[model samples]
Target: MTMTMTKLPRDLVEEILSRVPVKSIRAVRSTCKNWNLITKYERFANKHIDKATASERDKEFLVIAGDYLFSLNLNETHSRKFDLSINHRGISIAREHSDRTVFIAQAFLSQGLLLCVWRNVIDNRSRLLVWNPYWGKNKWIECPMTYCLYEWFAFGYDKSSGRHKILRFSSNNGDRYMEIYDLSSDSWRTLDAASDINTIKYMESGLSLKGNTYWYAIDYEKEDFNISLSSVKEEKLAVLFSPRDRFVIDIWVTNKTDPDAVSWSYFFKVETTQHLSGFLFENFLIDEEKKVIVIFDIYGGANNAYTISGETGHFRKVDLRQSPYKRPYRLVGCYIPSSVQI
Candidate 1:
């Protein structure tokens, strides 16, 4: 008599793979043809996302320090340098290049992946890279320069299409333009949405939550009463949509990704305590499970971090002196390290 191995059913295999860590799923797919097919299935992706979100874990913060990237604890007391190999333009490059080390300018987190806008240390040429830290893998996307003056970028994942997108806005000679890149197609297209908010012109990093992207902006012109009477009246109606008189930070959400029908909405606003005049809101991240919003602010030359209750509107500053590094860390995104291979 001889013993034989039995193969599990496809559905049973899928159920098991969906529950596994996202970073490990890529390897799981390689085990067999059936496993590979199941892992790439859309239903499997959705199930994996649900499992990943439902799991409870420590919140990790992504911070930029000089030419390196760091993942810090939410309490700001401990940090570990991320040592994954990073490459540009599909060419593997060593991070040890001190004279021409690459730096992340803008970054956003989607699911378990980190999307970054990086600049060359020598020539300052900008490019996009999507990195799966747990798996130590990244893919580079060439960024085409559309505007010569100023440019801003935002990253989001479109659940409907199962695609990642980068929104680029540039201004030249006071004229603003918008373009979008679809990772699936590996191409860029112009966005013709009629937007006059003037806030997207300067957004450095966008927050991607639940397949939607958001930017934090302050409507200063409307809040200032000393401006021209005609302009003040025009902005009065807009200000009413936001919180009154307080230090209001407007939340703008991306509504559509369709090039022909792209749009946005002023989703919500948060009013902070008074004396926020000199403070500049740099970046923010949301803890959906805990219902907490962490916003980073810059005052003078120091770091000002706050954790606010999403429901109560109460907030308090987070002390960062306990950390070893004294310099302000630019909080760009949130990172959840998993073994999910991309």
Candidate 2:
């Protein structure tokens, strides 16, 4: 007696389907009406995303190199790799700015949704984009004239309202005014957060944990800040600290993280190479189980990615020039897609 494919239990079917690549999920949905319906359920989508993200063999990250965006998977050899970019998401998102070459100037990940400021080559005009790559969906936001030079933007969600928001403020040298963009209303409003608020720049690590943004509060009492804060597994906050005077980098994680309360515990430390002196950018990802950390940085106009082992303290570096484009790499961290499309 032969068992038929249709005879497979629903649980088994879902388990198999969840492993399907997100880009190919649409095709899976098109296989049949029942399969299509299964993929549509909120539970199924979340399960698929979690399973795909958790698998070390299948895990991949989004990196923004010069003039292009690429996907990275550390489990594979350093040759050719899995790649998709803003241009591949389809034509409509960048339709208005067709004349200008599109490059992701800024990338911030919040609850898996990537908020990008796509910079155009024609005249350096900027466009705000919110993308849900898993579903192949995107939204282009209209910016108000109030947006200024040296402005930093963050993507976050309001748990109370169940709505997504963008925080915009001046950095470096500008006005004290803060503004926010609401996706529900498709409008911008003033946000009087702090006049003295100094935020992380585009080149710095911008960690969005549990659908919210976080930044280090300046300690007037302390002198040096040698740590970079990022999200580990998206369940906890991890900070990698490298003192200028030391050759070791330490990892710390906070189990309880919130705007009101956070306490960090030391994870471990690893020895670094002399080439690893630069600050870790917003584009690094940590593998907790493997005791490995893959980091990216652009220093002195050169692009390089490094991996440091917490278990053995071994160091290795990969040049971004190895990419097909041979362009400089401006590494942005992994892109985790949120269920919310906007």
Candidate 3:
């Protein structure tokens, strides 16, 4: 049977489109001329984009509940969870590696790609996989052993060279390195830019903005924190120190401002509950429309989740225990590479 667009009001259609995830909107627009015209409107598209982006910010938290990786949507009323077992009957790199037990160290969604790290159970070797969850397709790329040991890794786009790069530190030897993987050429190259930094011992966390990757680093003694920004095209690294002893810091690059001119000062920092403790800065949420940063804090003692906003430096407690889903065997949050985004 053919569908009729005449029955639905324009406002109602727009509202329904706004509620749908950004990934699905394009297909919906192709359904008919009315949708194509409505969705093509600059204002309408901007409205939906803003709504989707805001939803992504609030829904940044990732939890392994039951056998699924649950990512809360901005509405909180709705959520999208992917099965962790890798038997979901989809065209995913995760499914291709189903034979091997997968352990996700970090995951993030950016530019229509989900970048993640998975370990092979048999060989105990680590590999970086890029998957399109929406399309169910994935490609696995081998990560050097030197860069695999570090807990934090970030993958981002390089505008100048139009390549994808991964930045990670080698904790075993105190070596900070970056590996640039060219999707067009299907090859990887390591750069020596970050190798000279001695004081920036461990790469704590990272953020990707405007074709560059920004990392949070700590001194070997853990006395001070620093930030390093790398150019994907030039393969150059520049280091900057934080204004204070930022126990935990997270960076977010806003699209509203100039990509290159945007400075690190706009980033937000969260002071841990205790000084120099083991609290990890797992993930962060950036609300561009509201110009605020929401940070997720996971402590070892209670495994509780907290949020710190740029508007208020105070850390607010968030209740995750009340989630209806079953929790993972253990709750551990670590730095995830930018490549993994569902």
Candidate 4:
């Protein structure tokens, strides 16, 4: 008996296509011209994102492991060490640069696409490329200048223009310069990013949430706050400020994030009992609904995610890394699958 999808409504067909894995996107598109047209819409990407989240797809991290680009599923066992594979020419543009000296220094994922910066150690040169791992689509961008050591890269979309953009900024010599590369226009424009007075010198763990970029940083003139840069999502602000002394821990949140004026509402406070190092805050998430803070153990290399309860002040470590990782990997960020084109 032969099956037919011709009778199904377009919405039904879309729902089915959204359920299909992003890895098989090529095959799905080739199966039917209608399917190709449906998948091209932005709404279909949104539907696919919803389907993935609803299905409990393990949160993935797109990592640059030495010369290889690997995906590590944070929630699964064994796969944390990476069972997934990548064999695409787009990846090769960054992974296997003809110069040989050039290597993928950093990567950021937005809407199922990856913005990669290929660094050449010998010449101190950089190459920027926007790549879709799922579709094997690659767009190379000319780097106006070499990305310095302190300069960081972030990938986000412009809501108004509906274009994917890359932001590269660094606060070097007490001054900051921000440059944005627009994927649609294929151009680079500099933004008068910051002044010396408000410049952030020590910044790390930059995260892009809801088209706005946030980072965890330290000011030499001010105090430091321990917060989860990874667990940031939503319109409301959520933060974990467990000072270095670690006597009392608390969660503060607010509805407004206005630069001029904003106030934080007290969420919960947890008294300290167990000894958790500063590294625990490296890659963390605030379980707002559950009132728990999950911290990825990067220091121990034990492949554990430390989940701590706010009320009980108790925590448990779940081992996610199955094998010993030899190469030191710099975190790009949470890898979210998107059907959106680059």
Candidate 5:
């Protein structure tokens, strides 16, 4: 009753391993010579590398608080934190310029670049900074304004033009303006659009996906806000309406619930009560490979986080107060390809 490696086709085994998470595949590589050879194949390696990168992006959420930034690794029982504090030189410049600092402004991440904006204290100007934290390289561009400076802003990439655009709306004038920065040209130009008849309110927590930026908005009625999604590439807008009206919209990334498929479901909360809604819904990171969404909620002065499933919608809460390190406010998290890491 001896088992043979030839019993299973090599292609079949490769397919199975490709579907597994990269961590599991790494463990299997050491199991035997045949497994190691199969896992090390260039084709298999590239496929698994992409899968791992996408899984990380879908699973991790960058938490930005005050001066400190950290990455929250939610896969383990306790979350891991990585500090991203700028050096004294960078910190002093960031504090003096105001616009160079990364704050709670509209943030967009793509390729290896993170685009963010802050205010300039010396000139009272708004500036956009493009930086690659992974490589410690950054470039700053000043934004030109006509009247009052924008209180809220968003950063997005326009795929069609192959450039980045900054969308800012002024609360005082109820005007929304767009500035297109051609990364290749290193120039900026303003966009002309009809006035927004309705008062335009901006939400800081917007999600940028597929060259489009989506933000939560409250109508002039001062009631519940609706989800407003816009594409910088197309320069168009579309409204995504949820079933309930009183819900606070936060974006979640999950492949299990396809938007076009009949099984489409969104993970969010309807504010049933003031304090209770905050307790039930927590900001989380989605683990696509594990098929789980990890949520961290600081309630009752206790930092409790959990991971939920996209398919089953099951919840499990883990306490993190006992952990030595606490989650920082400003943190950067990214999923780099194994090839890139090497």
Candidate 6:
């Protein structure tokens, strides 16, 4: 039977495409040339990302387990692994311990892409690579050999300039050197953020919220209160503290944007009655709308996320099935899906 079908207007078609899931949109692009062009359009891609990110249910997480990459909905149970061999060639060395294996030493996610650090166990040849698994694209970046011994990497985007930068920090003797890599120029420049090696010796978790980057240190430093509260900006930094003396968790927030500013003040504290013994609290996420803080628990082989109420101070542990940590290595990051091509 022959039937006549009407084509959707370009604007209306794009609006409909922006509402569809990112994974499904990729599949439907091959339906027609117009659909393919619309899906690849930068404006349409940004629109879809904005809409998808606004809803928590449509979000997807990128998981790095062992040498594999997995993608899954945080609200669901199952995860599907992706073939990340797009840039795996010439980056790995043959290491024969019993047989041979390569591990994903470190990984960071920023603006819908992942920056990975791969280290060869046999030698000290380490490589930095960026991957956009959704689009099946990956590229290798030259690693700075000056701080190859000990260095930390962070990925963040600047909203004001729409540029992405990678922060690398390393220590030599007692002096710390900070380097910033600009993705726009594809170059690296040394930053003049003076720091005592002792001050940055211990850091627990790092998160990139909005356009700023923050690091939660294990050793809490005392800061002045009145000066930090002087800011009128709506955005602020909030730190969760779990002291070694008690089973109480403290939340501190500050509005000052200066790196050297002492603006943190106590917001609230949670006292847990449960036997949180032997349980290591690694990271946390704040759900401001729900007034709850989600805590990551890495104890034994049990991987759990505990949500504690801000008002009542009650908490419940969420079972996420598999342990985020495998042996001595663990992966942690938010699952944010977008249609923006890397």
Count of steric clashes across candidates, in order: 6, 5, 12, 0, 10, 1
- Give the per-residue lDDT of model 5 (tens digit) for 130-217: 6643333467776666555455555556666646555555434655555566665777777686545244454344455444444444
lDDT of each: 0.55, 0.66, 0.46, 0.61, 0.47, 0.56
Q: Write the per-residue lDDT of candidate 1 for residues 1-342, one digit (tens) a residue.
A: 553212666777778777886545557767778777676666777777678656643345566544445554433122321111111112132243455356666777676667777767565567778776545577788777653466677776677776777887776788878888887687989888755546542544555654556544546665552110000100111111223345765544334444334345443455766555454445454444344555555567556666665455667676554444455556555555443444
TM-score of 4: 0.70
- Ranking of all predicted structures according to lDDT, beginning with the best and ending with the worst: 2, 4, 6, 1, 5, 3
Clashing pairs in 2: 112-336, 112-337, 112-338, 283-332, 283-333
List, residue by residue over 1-342, the lDDT tens digit for candidate 2: 887657889888888898887657768988899898888777889998887776665555666554455566655234322122222332233435444387666667776776777765665456788877666677888666653555566778888877889887654345566778898889999865774455333345356777677766545556354666666666788777776677777888897987789998888888655645564544466767666777766666566677766776766676665556445554455555556655
Model 4 spans > 4 angstroms off: 1-13, 20-46, 50-94, 97-113, 132-136, 146-149, 170-176, 192-194, 197-203, 221-228, 234-237, 247-249, 258-263, 278-280, 300-303, 323-339
TM-score of 2: 0.77
Q: What TM-score does prediction 5 earn?
A: 0.54
Poorly placed runs, candidate 2 (over 4 Å): 1-16, 26-44, 50-56, 76-103, 119-125, 171-174, 199-205, 217-226, 279-282, 334-337
User: Which residue pairs in model 1 clash with each other?
Assistant: 22-340, 23-339, 23-340, 23-341, 24-339, 24-340
TM-score of 3: 0.54
For candidate 5, what is the total of clashing residue pairs?
10
What is the lDDT for 59 in model 2? 54
Q: Which residue ranges in model 5 land beyond 4 Å of their true spot?
A: 1-60, 76-104, 120-125, 145-149, 174-176, 195-201, 219-275, 279-282, 298-304, 309-342
What is the model-wide C-alpha lDDT for candidate 6? Answer: 0.56
**Which is better, 2 or 6, measured by lDDT?**
2
Worst 10 residues of 1 by lDDT: 228-237
**Best model per lDDT:** 2
Candidate 4 per-residue lDDT, tens place, 197-287, comes to 2444234435555555555445656675565544333345466676776655677776566545546777788776755544556455554
Residue 4, model 2, lDDT:
64
Sort the candidates on TM-score, descending order.
2, 6, 4, 1, 3, 5
TM-score for each of the candidates: 0.56, 0.77, 0.54, 0.70, 0.54, 0.70
